[model samples]
Target chain A: MRITIDEDKCCGAGQCVLAAPEVFDQRDEDGVVVLLDAEPPAEQHAAVTEAAQICPAAAIALA
Target chain B: MTEAPAAPAPALTTRRAPGCPFDPPPVTQELREQAPVTRVSLWNGSTAWLVTRHEEQVALLRDPRISADSRHSGYPTVSASFEATRAHNRTFITMDEPEHNAQRRRFTGDFTIKRMQALRPRIERIITDLLDAMEQAGPPADLVTDFALPLPSLVICELLGVPYEDHDFFQRCSAVMIDTRSAPEAALAASQELLDYLEKLVEFKAEQPGDDLLSRLAEQYLLTGESTVDECAKQARLLLIAGHETTANMIALGTCALLQHPDQLAAVRDGSPQRVAGAVEELLRYLTITHMGRRRVAVADIEVGGQLIRAGEAVICANDLANRDPEVFADPDRLDVDRAARAHLAFGSGPHQCLGQNLARIELQLAYPALLRRFPGLRLDRPLEELPFRTDMAVYGLHELPLSW
Candidate 1:
């Protein structure tokens, strides 16, 4: 799956990072999500999906 | 062109219905139905937009134009005391954008799900130990003082490197700060007391750092020159107060609510991990203990729910009412432990949603079942009406919960 984040909508609640740290990292400056990998192997797909589901701002989108 | 008739606005009242202690104020329900985005007169004689609909609240919280900065003119204050203390060193909660995000990020690591999960064993130990003491003390215990309050207070104290023994002092100050009826001078005094205590604690941590949140903050913010010692202390003070009070109340009030619904309480007491987690979320929704509405100001003109809120207009997002918005949760008033209730605004919404939610969740997840499992016959010692509830405080919760097995 390919993952992307809307920087403006990221609320820095940190749920994304906790759920899928391999795929998502927050910018040090403002804590906005920083995409670490656009596409990950099937092994990490569940984590990515969970991250998106847990995001309060709905800033994460996966295809 | 003739102007249409404007819906009459109901005056905001904090008093919950006479005996339905678990429900939101009666007038709040009326306003949610009649005028979800109507103007209500506050205690200070200032009127602000009181948004009650679940959809409207979520939209407003996410809108970039809305500001949570309490310093802005026309920003709705909970009371005159809140306005007086607004000028005190602002916590990240009251900050807007860039600054808010920057400050909030500094401590997010400590509250991340991984971190909170790691702390679960420690939190469980705390809960177990408290229960042991309560059991030792025998039946007819005031659960509020004995179990509910101390569990969170001790955990927070450990996290921040603050001595739990000093809880009485800090708790007193926190009570003064959040009490809307408190005098302005008293509020300021409380703020000063907590700030001063935190300042000293932060300074001490700088010299003798430990593996705790305050130590990390001192190293990162104070020692690195990213922030002043006082600024770091102010942030610590805010966390210290919020870390304990909100959860403490939730524990106490939640127990009271669960006892009222024995069937639901049974599920929470004897359920799987998934069931317990869902129960926690549902309880958070049903008893949105933070009854005082979130206050904000519009930095730009925004039209929502067929009403145009001009720039500088104040808005109060009443989460209690929003949580009960029938459109959001079917039979929103019912406390169904198994329902998918994670979307409730108990922790709020948007960028400024609660920082310690994951930790709070774990605490509740562990707390509810443990308490019930230990004392299966737990029941209120006094009638519901006789128990003291914190109606006047900023956070809605029971002041003292008397219980016996």
Candidate 2:
């Protein structure tokens, strides 16, 4: 899966990090989205997709 | 084309439907179907666009041009008192952009899902202790006072390092701030009093650091000059009030909803962790206690749902109605604990979506099963209709939920 995120759109609600921590993280300074792994392993694909779907700001997108 | 005589605009403050306490005010549901976003008159002599449909609510909330700053000219305040509170200190949620992000990020670590999971055992112990007290006191208790209010209050106190003994004081001030009935002067005074108290506490914490949030905030902000002492205090006050009031109401109201639906209550009682977690999301969606809507002002003209929200236009995202939008949730009115309800806007959406949600989730997850298991035969002490719901307050909840086992 190809993962994409717009940091400017992140509100730091932290749902992405919660859903797939190995692939997503928040900047400690301002809680904006930080991609930990742009192409995470297949095992993390479902969680990354779920995170993208539930992101309140629609900041995360995966293909 | 001649414009037919325009109908008089509806007042947004009208009471919720008589028999349907769980439903959004009937007018809002109707608006969702017809208008989706339409102007409504407020308690004050002002008009703001009330956005009702779930899709529109979500889209608009994520629009960065919409600002939540209460002090902005077109922002709709719940009442004169709510407007007055803005003159004092605006909490982080009411802020936008870089400032709000910076302030909110400061506390995100404390509420991350991972951090909250680590604190679950401690939260479970707190719930257990409260249940023990309720059990010892026996049946026929006002759950609002005996259990609901205190559980979150105590947890917030420990989290912020504020003494639990001072709950009565802060809670009273919080009520004044949120109570739509309070006079502007009274509300202003209550806010000032709480600010002064918090300022003092922040000062004390700075001098004598502890593991609590306030002390840590003090070391991080004050010591580094990232924020002023007053700023830290105001943030603490926001956390204390939001942390307890919303969750407390949820506990009482959720329990009441469960009792009304024995099958749903049984589902929660079964305690399969996944089932219970799903139940919490369903309960949050069904009982969106922040019924006044999240108010905002459009900073730039934006077309949403085929309507143009012009710059400087006030908007209220009616979440309660949005949660029940039939286009999103099937059989929306039914209380089904197993429903997939995580997408609901109970904690709101966008940058200002509830910051304490992770903490709130754990509290509710532990609260429901613990309360139910402790009092196996729990039921309402009086007829459900006779109980007074806090409709007059900015937040929707039971004023006092009486219970018996």
The model with the greatest DockQ is 2
Model 2 C-alpha lDDT per residue in residues B122-192, reported as the tens digit of each score: 88888888888888988889998998999889988998999999989999999988899999999999888
Instruction: Name the 10 consecutive residues with the lowest summed lDDT in model 1 chain B.
Output: B1-10
Candidate 1 lDDT, B1-405, residue by residue in tens: 112237554577789887899899998888788766888888877778889898888889877899999889898888878889998958889998878877887877677666677889999999999999999999999988998889999999999899999999999999999998999999999999889889888989999999888998899889999899889989998889889999999999999999999999999998999889889889999999888887899999888877888899999999999889888789988989998776688888877899888788899999999999999999999999888999989888988999999
Number of colliding residue pairs in each model:
0, 0
Give the residue spans of candidate 1 off by over 4 A: A7-9, A14-54, B1-9
Query: What's the distance in Å from true for residue B280, model 2?
Result: 0.4
| lDDT agreement with native, every candidate | 0.87, 0.86
Model 2 native-contact share: 0.43
Whole-model lDDT, candidate 2? 0.86
Best TM-score among the predictions, by candidate number: 2
Give candidate 2's TM-score: 0.95
